[model samples]
Target: MTLSVTRTARGMVQPSGQTPTGTLHLSFIDRLPVLRCNARTLHVFRHGHEPAEIIREALSKALVPYYPLAGRLKESSQGELQIACTGEGLWFVQASADCSMDAVNYFDNIPMVHHEKLLPDLLTEVDDLDPLVLMQVTQFTCGGFVMGLIFCHSICDGLGAAQFLSAVGELARGLHHPSVAPVWCREALATTAPQVYATGKANPPPPLPFLPDYQLKHATMDITPDQINQLKHEFQESTGQTCSTFEIVAARMWSRRTKAINLEKDAKVTLVIFANARQLLHPPLPKGFYGNCFFPVTITVSSEKVSQASHAEVVKLIQESKSMLPIEFTKWINGNSVGDVDPFAPPLAYTTMFISEWGRLGFNQVDYGWGPPVHMIPIQGSSIIPVAIVGTPPKPKKGIRLMTWSVSGPHLQNFLEQMLNLT
Candidate 1:
């Protein structure tokens, strides 16, 4: 399928007259290492109303509460990021694809060359002035369409973006207001005490020299519900405890990927996962606190252990790592010095895997008057650490769709074989 651009425009979703206007500082959570990067998402719908008109109108309403999204990001003298609430517009593009959704196999294993056509390009580099978010609405010949969004990680995280998008959908459906009000409490995570580091941003140094480049390859695969259940059952029977689907699946992938690369038996490996802290903080954030509210949990083990350990064993290790969420979040909130290491840093020695679960993120619930999205996918596949983007399966099906991006090395085939054979 080929996509042709029809229009390129920008719209300013100004805050209401009563809304306050000023520079808003980024919270500690917002400055997390990986949060500085940009992320993309695509929402697919069938035979929907005029998506361009609906989205523009709904976005204006959403921006009244999500004004920061319309603002421009700037760096402070200390090198920290802050939103300058100038009411500047966001970039939006309109395009049409020559083929229908089914013709592209519902975006299953979409070619990398074509993926760039579906979303906005990554900024050459993070600069002082740039749109916090960019979006594209592409219509297919069969009347189906997709909404692609690229958001700067400095402004918000996945949950924040989802909340704002949900508001747009609610407004498109003619709701008088959003289901949840947006909240900003950056001061709560700020400190009156002076800091000595550069912006206190603590951007980590580059990875050590030994890490091998993976040549950046991407693929999407699915895991049947039965496969998930079987793994869970086996782990429970062996360990006398049940594990969440994500924990089990992530552990399995970590084990398999390490073995696939034929790493030295005694090399070190690490698995990193971010846990939400909205309700985990000492005094929980507001119900709709829309910002970066998560911390990364890293688990290090030897390659031999990661490759040879039982599924139950790895899951237990992940569980233990997660159990420290509250403590870690509190430390970040109190302005304590957190590790300078990047959570998504490249795995140089043995292996490093970062796993993110979007199934419960309500990707399928962002309805814009013509029912919910039929499909969604994230752009920006990484080549450093292997990444697994897991989402809920299609309706009436019992399973998950796993989209992974890795280096196109000799290990690629073995890694994929192990993943597919798990079912």
Candidate 2:
């Protein structure tokens, strides 16, 4: 029989204590054009005792300091987004699967389509009164559980999400208070220049085209430690400079993806890479300030330039783009600019590439008494543009896992050749 998940219980989990109620304005970073959506992640735990209940209870307590999560999204009279801390609570669901962890290979090999079922479904388009946080815990027959968490992107970035998840884990372990007291200083990130935001509100980017299921293909490939080392050695030999593994992989991905898609020589191809911007601020955001602070480092060039460029050359291009992040961030924070493209909502006909690096986002560090999760993956894959997500390696594994989505006919096969043919 095909395995299935059954929801045993579901409800709103309220805070353990009275939470402050008010209308909290969002930060400038929180109002980015591309951040008006939900973020999703699934975590796998191989062993745990009543994890669903433990997490459910812990979530209630976790909502006190993170009270804004218990609230709903609302709009101000001036048509700006803000939070109404109603103490309505977060949506929680307890579920059980008919199969064991081993049945699915600990979810390491599961398809992205199946991951969609694990997360709580929400409207593709969010609106006022929508819950900011929604979560579900599906317990496996073998005492393991998979936690599907979705939070508003406007509230936090990947690193900020990690911070919130870590709090829930700590509370589940019976901690009286979070190690890092949560901070809500959105004003610190307020922008002096509001034209970009105001203009975005008036003329939002066009809606993304959701391709038919058959037209999209989701695939992944692993880059092992040895392979990474070899690439680093090759890069240093050729360029006489050191770079992160992401720089090498992303550079290669851009180069091969451009060639595989067969864009016009003069066609414009863009790459948007996710990078942390907490320290890029003049004085830096305060610690424990969980909010949207990731900046998309973008670079666009002619297809002829990227597709024909050497791997080392492509890496240099990405490096140059990244090096400009500090200046770009400074300008944006001061309201002097809006990025070339939105991080999540890039503009393109068929030549946009997006890369989000999750290896250092702290997802692997969240542990709920039973110990940290052994594996984690995002539930995604239904976009017209080619996108790649690099996640932290699961336990006992080294290096990173690449999850890719492309609508092109030769997308996966060509990408595989690019990954393996590093000669």
Candidate 3:
């Protein structure tokens, strides 16, 4: 169904109260060279009981605590990135759709909903939009709304973004403070440049572009819970080892994707596992750090192995990846890393497959009076890398949804056939 959405208003929203002023040093995890990208998401709500102003106002108040978000991204004298506490404010847009929630099936009909129209355009923005956070509230005729947001990847990961948004919801609901108070002590995760640049200098390398060029067809696949459980059982039976939901799912999907892409027989394929590292630290990061903390664990094997290996073999590789987090986390936070990644590090943008597990991020639980969001959508903006967003299904649904932007043409057809015929 074709839907028409009209932009109603736009402006910058400043913090409701005075915030600290000065530069906030970014941690090693926050300034990862391979993590320079934006995380765009879509949230579906079922009620219009809350006006757009309510969220806008709440966002202002939320900024009082999450002031780093309102600040602009700055580059230090050494080319490293940091947040300058200017508190310029958040960029907000108001929109309305001619159709209702039912018309788009509450955004569950991923292929039918015009996500681009539901989001704010970064190209035409004048709010010093160099990776600045942007939000859009699009109201539907049925008194429901869709909230779209764009967060700077360098500033926060998926879970961190959810925490911040939830804070905004708390304020909207008239809370004096967030249940999980905001914490900004990021220096604990900072790097010391143990290995200087090959030029023997102290500065880090220049950052890659935040977004990858989109040249592949984007599609979302919904896998039922039954299929997931069956796969899990099969994996354990085959490997004689019990694996978590992500291990088996990632293993199977990686194998299937490898076969679909039909890469060279001996090409080395890297599976990047974006594991949450909140608990792997020496003292563990606080519950409310709200910054980039996920450690991208990589497992590289021959394409032949990935395509031919039994689900057990691939899953074991994934298990190995996660098992190395403790040591890797130690090196990263202890400043043994070079620009947060060594030369031997697998180039994440070129990794064979990059999948972000969002099922546990609590993004769908953000509510500002209207019930929890029914769906959390991810917009694959101009991202150049081949990445997939694996997230929890909307309400009343029992399964996971995989939004893929890695393959196209016959590859997509093959992948779809495997998904629909999942046993």
Candidate 4:
């Protein structure tokens, strides 16, 4: 979709607040394209039908401390730095009351709703929308609701945005003061000078050709516990190998998608797995070091390998890739060693992607005084289908919940069938 830029009243505000002192640097990773979308839902208490005034009041108060950086958009002026605080940046709104609570809940329950439809619908209505970043609230008929969030990779990574959202939830509930305060580390991400580079090593791979005028498509499927188990058993039975929920599903879908696209056999596809390194690094990142801190752990293989390989072999390859990540990887990113690399280079084989929130450890306890959310559904992006595994909300009988954005309706249906077999 074409991204239109227009001036707005919100973008003119100056950064007059108590800005932090140090230069928070972001490493030179590609300006994570404006292509990223981090969507999610939150179910509220049954009786929590506070008037829209109260809700707005709560959000206003909670978001004040974050205002300085929250609504600001990025702008580059003559190769110099500039931040546009007016007319652009983060966007927030509340969905119309026409849709009932049950309808909203039903919508959330539908796995991986396609962004092609949902995102455009949201943008068309929210006029001042920035394809780069935005968030909104949708109320349901049952007095319950969902919070939809979207972030531009240029601002914060998925984990970074989650950190920001958790803080918002906490502030609304009157929890502790805004966490760790927001910091802009964009300067730290400047490209390195050629002299600083280590010579003799292989030069970074050529940058991936940008995909031209691509359109977004998304799909989702729901699977029962029994079905999931059966899929797992079938995969093991077929290949004598086991895969994590994401690996198994991802492998199958990637193979199918590449074939459908009519890709060449020797062409490699890249599976970019978003790894949450919050606790994996040394001296672990502070509880509030929000920004794009995630590093992609890629698994590259050709379409032929993916099509001919057994499920077990693919699973092993995925597992091996994950195992390769270490604390040093973060350091590598921070040090700019990763700069020589291209963020979009196509893989040697069919590529698919995975991101999981299995533990739900950090933000699950977000109690905004209204009580913790009974459910949370993340919106899927337009580029690549992402798999997110989150803990079911506290209220709905303790168990694991899986959510994913699909590339096609047929692919999603087939995936749900395989996942059902696992159960």
What C-alpha lDDT do the candidate models reach, one value each? 0.72, 0.80, 0.77, 0.48
What root-mean-square deviation over C-alphas does model 3 reach? 3.5
Query: Where does candidate 1 stray beyond 4 Å?
Result: 1-5, 8-18, 121-129, 192-212, 332-350, 394-397
* Residue-level error in angstroms, candidate 4, position 173: 2.3
Residue 376 miss distance in model 1 (angstroms)? 1.1
Instruction: Supply candidate 2's per-residue lDDT for 289.
Output: 86
Write down the RMSD of all candidates, one decimal each.
Answer: 3.4, 3.0, 3.5, 7.3
What is the TM-score of each predicted model, taking all chains together? 0.89, 0.92, 0.89, 0.65
Order of all candidates by TM-score, from best down to worst? 2, 3, 1, 4
Per model, state how many residue pairs clash.
Answer: 2, 0, 4, 43
Q: Would you give me the overall lDDT of model 2?
A: 0.80
Candidate 1 clash pair list: 211-348, 214-407
* True-vs-predicted CA distance for residue 106, candidate 1, Å: 2.2
Candidate 1 per-residue lDDT over residues 348-418, each given as its tens digit: 43366777888776667888888887777777545566777778655445688777775466778888887
Stretches of candidate 3 off by over 4 Å are 122-125, 129-131, 193-214, 335-345, 348-351, 382-384
Best by TM-score: 2
Residues 8-120 of candidate 4 have per-residue lDDT tens digits of: 11221222234333222233342333223344433334334542334445445444554434454343432222334342234445553444545444444453333232321
Q: Quantify how close model 2 is to the true structure by its C-alpha RMSD in Å.
A: 3.0
Q: For model 3, where is the 10-residue window of minimal lDDT?
A: 193-202
**Deviation in angstroms for 116 in model 2?**
4.0
lDDT of 3 by residue, 50-147 (tens): 45889999999999989888998878786767788988888888988898898788877665668789887644647455546899999988899999
